[model samples]
Target chain A: MDSGTESASADAWDGEIETEIGHDEYDPYGTLTLIGIYFVIIALLWVFMYFVEFLGEGPTVM
Target chain B: MEIHRYETIWFAASLLLIVGFIGTITYGAVGVGVEMVDDSGGTVDPDNLGSHERFGDTGVHKVNESHYEVNMIAVHPSFIPSEIEIPAGSTVTFYMTASDVTHGFKLVDSNLNTMIIPGQVSEITAEFDEPGEYGFVCHEYCGSLHHEMAGNLSVVPEDEWGGVDS
Candidate 1:
């Protein structure tokens, strides 16, 4: 997907969660799903860094 | 058969690169428990030592009094002042800063790996314990020309420096 759609979904999730926790609105409509997606992305990045050595030990020909 | 030859050569070259990368990382971070010195060295003053004139030397940079100061500008695949010769027992402080991106500053046979941020000077010091040819290169992959960023450092004894036998 394009970067714009990805970011829009992320921001929309954050907004929805904030609304759910506030007194003005109580719409918990699957906001936890957004949080799960965020965690998944973070975990994937951690794995990539651990094995691929991305930008850690300088540059490699391989 | 010709493709096999190419594959073998590629494999060999890649193996050497891996070895070099491992050496760089080891020298950069291994066996150093103490805290690293803050890399900010003295501010750059071209007129203080007239160092601006020494850029792009073909490997034997002539500095005065057998002792000198230098600024190794970070660029794609290498440091700006690529090759250098320093006298033994003297500390050569590298005033490093990247012009392009974040590059790794490290020395072979010593722990000097540091992140050189773009537009921010990071000072690193190195003292050669033995007079010999030491290999060093930028461990950070900035671009496709990364292999060309390699260079050699020669540490000569004080007596042999400046053509003086003393």
Candidate 2:
């Protein structure tokens, strides 16, 4: 029964799907843009925290 | 196996982020001259604290013109020298230990924080640039009245600073 269904689906779907481009050709520009923005935000926050928040709150231990 | 271009880029970016974090910490330590608490002060028997030289007489003492040493003890619910006074623009080294249980010493709104262990001494050096009063509290919960374990650090102006007792 499993072999029958597998064969039936294989025959039905054989020419139904078409690959226009390879996976390697895909460029995730949106992901790169989003990550770049996130990186900038993190860097800015780190600077604000280290310099403004930490160093600003002085009388610090050496 | 083939990897995507974005995957390689992301890997490189991740490496950059890690390296950047290490660089920042290194800069803070080297450039900013931030020191960390360590075991340089050595160990002591908490039970025999009364015989110990420094912890026995726990208070602030002037080392020289620009340096001072504060020997402190943290017991159950209080610091031995509850009130501390120092001159402004002086480097103060706090040498502390615990008698009974473990406790924490945290100078509120400052970077001065360390653990007080029974058999070990915790030492931290701090520099106060201005004359002001800073409150400190034991952040680690040790006993029932842990919240009551608080103290004050007063940095007095240079003109009004008193010399150390002999």
Candidate 3:
């Protein structure tokens, strides 16, 4: 059962590469975009936690 | 080292993020005046907590017009003088210690949080500018009724603030 699905999926990419792309021409913009989004999320969370949960909590230690 | 432009950008961004993180914490400490519970409370003998000067008489004491000191003791499943009452617009310094085991003291909705070890003391000071009620709990699990280990802190209006009710 596993061999049939494996071979069928493997055959789809069995063809040779039509064009070769070198490292200098490749750009991982997608990874950059993903990391940028993650950074924004983390920064937002830090602001909320620090400003709202911590500072806005009131009666903080002096 | 030869690095790609994208890698360089990512590296610079990462450095900025780290610096921003440190700057935020510094601002909190310096600008906002956030403090940590330290060894200022000093040490005590767990077995002789009853003989301690402050811990011996666990309750609220008025230092001056704007300052107050609260001496508290934490046992297995309860806090001595659990119902703490104080006046609003006052600064309070909580002196807490545990007699049996280690416990945590965390005032809900406030930054008044610390740990109470058997032989060690935890001291934290905070300013209550508004009149409100805060619930404090033992964040550490000590025994069977650890969840039930909680207390109430009432910051009443200055005019309505009566001395500690014996």
For model 1 the local lDDT of residue B22 reads 70
Q: State each candidate's chain A TM-score.
A: 0.40, 0.64, 0.61
What would the per-residue lDDT of candidate 3 be over residues B52-75, giving only the tens digit for each residue?
Answer: 888888999989899999999999
Scored by lDDT, model 3 comes in at 0.90
What candidate 3 gets wrong by more than 4 Å, as runs, is A1-17, A20-22
Candidate 2: global Cα-lDDT? 0.88
Task: Give the range of the ten consecutive residues with the poorest summed lDDT in model 3 chain B.
Answer: B1-10
* Per-candidate interface DockQ score: 0.01, 0.65, 0.61
TM accuracy, model 3 = 0.88
lDDT minimum window of 10 residues, candidate 2 chain B: B157-166
lDDT digits (tens) for residues B1-166 of candidate 1: 2344334545775576567657645644554322355634533332232344322222233345543555677777777667677777665656666667778766665555677666456765555556887677778887888767767767788887653121
Assess chain B of each prediction and give its TM-score. 0.59, 0.94, 0.96
Look at candidate 1 and tell me the lDDT of residue B9.
Answer: 48
**Fnat per model, in the order given?**
0.00, 0.74, 0.81
Reference-based lDDT, residue B152, model 1: 72
Q: In terms of DockQ, which candidate is strongest?
A: 2
